[model samples]
Target: MRIALFFALILFHFSSISQSTDERAIREVLAQQVECWNEGDLECFMEGYWKSEQLVFIGSKGLTYGWQQTLDNYKKRYPDKSAMGILSFELIIVEPLSEDFWTVIGKWNLKLNSDNPNGHFSLIFRRLGDEWVIVSDHSS
Candidate 1:
């Protein structure tokens, strides 16, 4: 019984450490995206997303698949720096779905061309090897 208890304690400690590390990485990924967007670098902003054809993005228009397609849509929507504007996010929730998956909810606010456009977003991230990449995004 003591051996089992000792093993259980070790398992719990390992899980706690893993979760903290994952949360930090995920936060960094989201922060990098905001920084890239604020710098008017749409291409860099896309780095936070999974660079796969299977990746999905849902925006005001509709659903778009593939990294290049999503980048194209962003470029089309925000043609210039004035359009892209300053981007900020209010993270509401960051919950783990599994060991390698997480779901994040946040509010995105953009200050652009005299318009303050704000909306809610829900993002799903998957650990691809080491780093986390957003697999699916839904923003309104």
Candidate 2:
């Protein structure tokens, strides 16, 4: 009985460690995106997202599918640095849905020359291969 209990505790410890590592990785991806956005590099910002036709994004404009489509929409809306502005994010929740999936809820703010536009976002991240990438995003 003692041996069984010891093994269970070991398993729990490893599981928690894995989850912590995954959470840190997800946060790093968001940090990279913010840095890319602040630098006015839309392409670089998109590196945080999953580059696939299955990718989905929903915004004030409505539902958009595919990685290229999302990038196109961003370009259409924020054509210049003034429009893109400096981006910041406030994460409220980052919870794991399963071993390979996680959900993030956060507030995003853009500091522009004209005005600041802020909104909340919900993102679903999936572990694909060795990297965690945002597969779906809903922002308004």
**Candidate closest to the true structure, highest lDDT:** 2
Any idea what lDDT model 2 has?
Answer: 0.96
Root mean square deviation (Cα) for candidate 2: 0.7
Among the numbered candidates, top TM-score falls to 2
Work out the TM-score per prediction: 0.97, 0.98
Q: Model 2: which ten-residue window has the lowest total lDDT?
A: 77-86
lDDT of all the models against the reference? 0.95, 0.96
Candidate 1 displacement at residue 113 in angstroms: 3.4
Per-residue lDDT for 1-140 in model 2, tens only?
99999999999999999999999999999999999898889999999999999999999878999999999999999897778999999999999999999999999998988899999999999999999999999999
| True-vs-predicted CA distance for residue 126, candidate 1, Å | 0.5
Candidate 1 backbone collisions, by pair? none
RMSD of each: 0.9, 0.7
Local accuracy of candidate 1 as per-residue lDDT tens digits, 1-140? 99999999999999999999999999999999999998889999999999999999998888999999999999999997778999999999998999899999999999877889999999999999999999999999
- Stretches of candidate 1 above 4 Å error? none
